[model samples]
Target: MKLILVVVLTTAIAAIGITLSLILSQRQAARDRALSIISGNKLQDATGKPSDKNDPNKRRAALARKLKESEQEEKDDKKKKEKGKSTMRELIQQAGFDFPVSYYYILSIVSAAAFTIGAFSLGFPRIVIAMISIIGFFGFPRLVLFLLTKRRQKKFLEDFADALEAMMRLLKAGMPMNEAVKMCAKEFEGPIGEEMSRIYELQKIGTPLGEAAVLVAKRMPIPEMRMFATGLLIQQQTGSSLSDILGNLAKVIRSRFQLKRKVKALSAEAKSSAGIIAAMPPLVALGLNTFNPGYIDIIFETRSGHIGLACFGLWMFTGMVIMWKMSNFKV
Candidate 1:
């Protein structure tokens, strides 16, 4: 029995040592392979590749990699477009416009018809009226939507800081987030209130705070709101001091709002100048028609005159756009 026990012990020891050695060797091999790759010494075919098959395989691999990259890029671009669409939809909602996505197309058709008719009635040639119609069809809706949405977004941003402050106070009082949002929805007015109402509905539907944050960020698409949502989500996930986090964020947002006001004050003159310049051409034409009655009648009476007016209008619009972009401050 003693001899049998000794034999068994010896065999167990041998097995353990073999397994340990194998594990150590494998770890060492892995480290070596990693080091080799890092040092730009990746292992190559040991059999000195069958040249023809090797080249073909390498080419195929490269092509596959490029195809994968292009596909990934396409997916990223598509995601960007979807993100833009979402923000644009939200902007329209904020502006109290119930227009469907198809509204732009319908408006474009109407605008084209209207511009064609108006220009033709003014004695413009068919070709000139057609060009103006095309421009109006493409541009009028975009311009109107842009101006309305920008104004609404500005109003929302102004009021949004107040909402954040209200929320911070409620949170500090130990009110639950959904309850705080509900209060804000009830007490606040305008775009911010409507947005909070949506949040309350989302919360009532049992959406997780993290996912809700992402949703709100997508809808609002503003830096302050996004920061607030991100803070809420992180606090939810990591169990942080919600009140303190929100309080600090609210302070920061208010400070940003003040800075924006100061910037607006400083840039007010430039913005006014840009606006006046943009308005000058139309205003001058209106004044000339009112005062002189037949001044620039040739512009509407002859084909050459029509061509000149169209060219001048195009250049004036381009200049207006450039001035507006330059005068505008993103913040």
Candidate 2:
């Protein structure tokens, strides 16, 4: 048990240290790349004689600046929306739950009570039981919420392009944007259907189509969803062809989905290795306790041993989180 604890702690600390170093290195590399790009652009501009209004370099610089401005505006908009809503409410909405936030509180209370009772029945020490209860109350519910939100988002993304194509076909059939959205709400199922229904409902309640799209984007907060909303907003403002915009957006989404799959496939081996490495210490300890009697008693019987075990578990959790973040690609 002692050996297992030490191994887990050492591995976790080392993994965390490595993760931090990699993050710092990546940031520094990004900064260097940005600086290099800026310097290269400046050098090219200096070497070239001032050209007419059709200068490609100037056009490129202006485009880049506009892109940056648009990105900053999007960021500010997201921040404002986030700030206006409660985090828990947003999480619940993302998880597809329509219950009030009070339900979450009730669920947490029940979880904490159940955990406390189970720990007591198992003969755990008071401090250990308290820690478990606290985790049940706070950590477990949030973890569940995160998992649900992620699963819902993944499902939405998987079917999103298809939804867009459906909507595009409706538009091409001479249906107005509102009718197309309403048809999508009825035609699809799962996250896409639910979100489309929401948008349709908002529109029915006298909300502008653009505002409804914005609200849907706010709820989902995914890039693809935002792109869809932006497309709607642009079409409304500029009188562009909605069918063409939806078709292009659908293509882009499909491309992004393909890239994500490729990245996940490439990272599968690393993720599997991390999972195995993380499970080994606990499995070894369980084996020792089962086959070699009293091998883990020290960890349960002594306060100092218990503290060490807790620290070991905490670090192990930290390491797993860091590894998960490392393996996950935002694209």
Candidate 3:
């Protein structure tokens, strides 16, 4: 009994010593955790190395970087959207339409409404009227704009060559670069003078010559204008004979114009053939309707007839588009 009591007492003291050591280690660990949080440092492990995986500071920094990147991406997306929107507006402006976009929308709506009423008054079915209205609203406006834009671009191209020639002449006469541009603007008429005056005005406002050239190039988007702008900027940056460069560019422009005319002349027969093919069915139907009343009325008079006409129209448009594409030859 006395030996058992001695062993029990020794075991109790050992257990107490172990418990005290554990409590002291727990308190030390708590103090270390507090200091780590305060100093913005990672908690060190038993090997005396910082554990980045479990570090709050590192996690916070990573999150901050991600947030910054996301913000930058949003800004870039916004810029792209704005640029696209502005590009369309610029095209409309370049086409010489000074009206607001809302004007076109209102015009389209009014046109659709008027066409629907007109078609209904002509005893057309609802589906036929709908088709007519859609064509009036969308197709007509687009066709008009397309024609106008092409005409304006053609006029610009014709005048641009002359302007380049005039610039070369002025440069040969020993006029300063800016003065030469001003003289060209005053000497020309139509789109060339207008565009050159715009460039001169931009220069007056302290826009750099290269930036001004780039702006006009983007506005017109013609290869000759782009080449001219690039050549001028390059020659301005390096020492080069401005007159010689302008004269060569003018010659190239005239050659390209001549080539374009030749191509158009060569393709005229194909274009005329396609147009005749596309127009034959409608023209024949009109002739038949005139000679034999109600002969073509079945096309839009009954539901089956409406469906047939729809399919026929679709195929006819497809064939016409194919022929048009085949007739086109790029320079």
Candidate 4:
């Protein structure tokens, strides 16, 4: 039994050693292959040229040519990217109306049509139905558009500060201004990066940097962005260091973002109060109608009651509008 155990131990040890040796050999072979590729010592099989076979210098020269071709392909790709960007900017310009106007018109038309249909179907009083249509067509859609624009602008502003910081880092890393901008556009998501990408494209297509910057500012309609773009334009024209300019711009944007956040925090309570006040009347009425339908029905039982309800609705609307305006603070 002792002799058998000793033979088994020896066999297992030998097997383990062989496996380790194989692994080491494989790793060494991989390393050698990689080093050969890096040193341009590896060559394709030479069937056509007898002199090229086994020639290290020929292999190195072939590798050099391959590298040059790869570099040219990279340059071509960059040019194509720039061209695509310029085309998109041109399309945006050709669309003519800004987003806000386009959104407002479409919403207003839809709202007007809906209200007209609803009014006719419900046999609502002529005056009340007319007021509804008028509000839907003229007032409500504009309000919706204004709210959406403000929200979108706020989101863009928040994103812009971070994008600026990213651009600063890329600039510090020795990237050119346009390349840094392109990197930011590619790395970040949403409107801020999207707008910068558009500008980068425009610059590639021979649009003066200043003109492209101005166009971006106009499209965004943000003061901070306008200032940033103007700074870039001036830097480009005057041969200033873009890295330092971008760094400073990044700092300023972050400060503005901090200040805006502080303002929003301070205004939170007032905004909540306005929202609650605006919402309370409708919610309380809803509860009363649900719990005591007979009590609420008296208001609609008489002609005078109908007139009172209409006036009350107008008053409630006015109050809500006032509250909404008071709560809105531009950052």
Best lDDT goes to which candidate? 2
Cα displacement (angstroms), candidate 4, residue 81, comes to: 36
**Clash count, predicted structure 4:** 0
The best-first sequence of candidates by lDDT reads 2, 3, 1, 4
In the range 238-321, model 2's lDDT, one tens digit per residue, is 444578778878987898799899999999998998899899999999999899999789999998787778777877887787
**Global lDDT of each model?**
0.68, 0.79, 0.70, 0.66
The TM-score that candidate 3 achieves is 0.64
Lowest lDDT sum, 10 consecutive residues, model 4, at: 87-96
lDDT of 1 by residue, 91-162 (tens): 556455767767767878999899888998999988898899988897776677778766766888888767
- Predicted candidate 3 versus true structure: per-residue lDDT over 1-331, tens digit per residue: 5564565556556555655665566656644543343234233444666454535565455434533543574477478767765544555666767688778768878888888889999999888998999998987776777777778779988877788888888887888777888887898877787778778888999997656876776566565776677666545544346776677778777877888899888889999998888889899998999999997788878866765675567567656655665566444
Number of clashes in model 2? 0
What's model 1's lDDT at 198?
Answer: 80
Q: Which segments of model 2 are wrong by more than 4 Å?
A: 1-85, 293-322
Error of 2 at 182 (Å): 0.6
Best by TM-score: 2
RMSD of each: 26.6, 7.6, 28.3, 28.1
The residue pairs in collision within model 3 are none
Superposition error at 129 for model 3 (Å): 3.3
lDDT of 4 at 165: 76
